[model samples]
Target: MDTSPYLQSRQRLVPAPPRAVFELLADPAMHPVIDGSGTVRAARGGSPDRLRLGAEFGMDMRLGVPYRISNTVVEFEDGRTIAWRHFSGHRWRYELEPVDGGTLVRETWDASRLKHKWALRVLGFTRTTPGNMERTLERLAAQFDGGATPS
Candidate 1:
């Protein structure tokens, strides 16, 4: 189990190049196609075609009730890393590294900067997010691996 109080991450070896993986991550329109949690519905209007540092975008989402959220890209490193945060100050980050045969992708849910870290834990985010991230990565990898459906 992770000892970190405010962050959870999962990694997978994806059989794709860093640029290919980064392209998918940088496009908000593709989020729902790859989302494992099933909360993301679609990208809102006016979002940039490609995300960069300081860019803002909105997503239509639903956990139980439909809602919308806005996010800003807080970190970017071309094909290597990207991270975004919404109003709550937590971030969703992806880092890619070129390995021997493919890219090693790491997805992280970072709540280290949130004010109510304990609240998320109490709400079971800490317990549930890792599995969600793992599935997200699986879906991402599937996009490059002969179109295998991600379960």
Candidate 2:
């Protein structure tokens, strides 16, 4: 986990190969299945089927109010890491490391570049993000343990 002042991260050892996990991450349509925030409702039209660097995808989100967010893939390293940033300028990143039993997946929420950092911090997202990341990893791991990724 990153201990830096600007990022919150969580790591989990998932019993799935990096390639398999990467495939799921690269597909924007599968995001709602692994999202821990519970805000992602669906992938909207015009989103990419498989995301690559610079690809843009739109997600229907609901957090008391229904809305959509368009995110751009900011980083991609085939089977290793992927990150995206939305209009808010914060980044959501995932890193995968091959381990003995499976893969060590680290998910990060970076708000260092957020325009309204004080506002978000006041909202207590800083305290909530790590737990959400842990749940996200668990859900991703469950997808490999005799369970199907929700469609």
Please estimate how well model 2 matches the true structure, expressed as its whole-model Cα lDDT. Answer: 0.88
Backbone-clash count (model 1):
0
Clashing pairs in 1: none
Clashes of each: 0, 0
Task: Give me the candidate number with maximum lDDT.
Answer: 1
Candidates' C-alpha lDDT: 0.92, 0.88
Measured by TM-score, the strongest candidate is 1
Residue pairs in steric clash, candidate 2?
none
Per-residue lDDT of model 1, residues 1-151, tens digit only: 3568578888999999999999999999999988988899999999999999999999999989999999999999999999999889999999999998789999989998887889999988888888899999999999989887586
* True-vs-predicted CA distance for residue 29, candidate 2, Å: 1.1
How does model 2 score by TM-score?
0.92
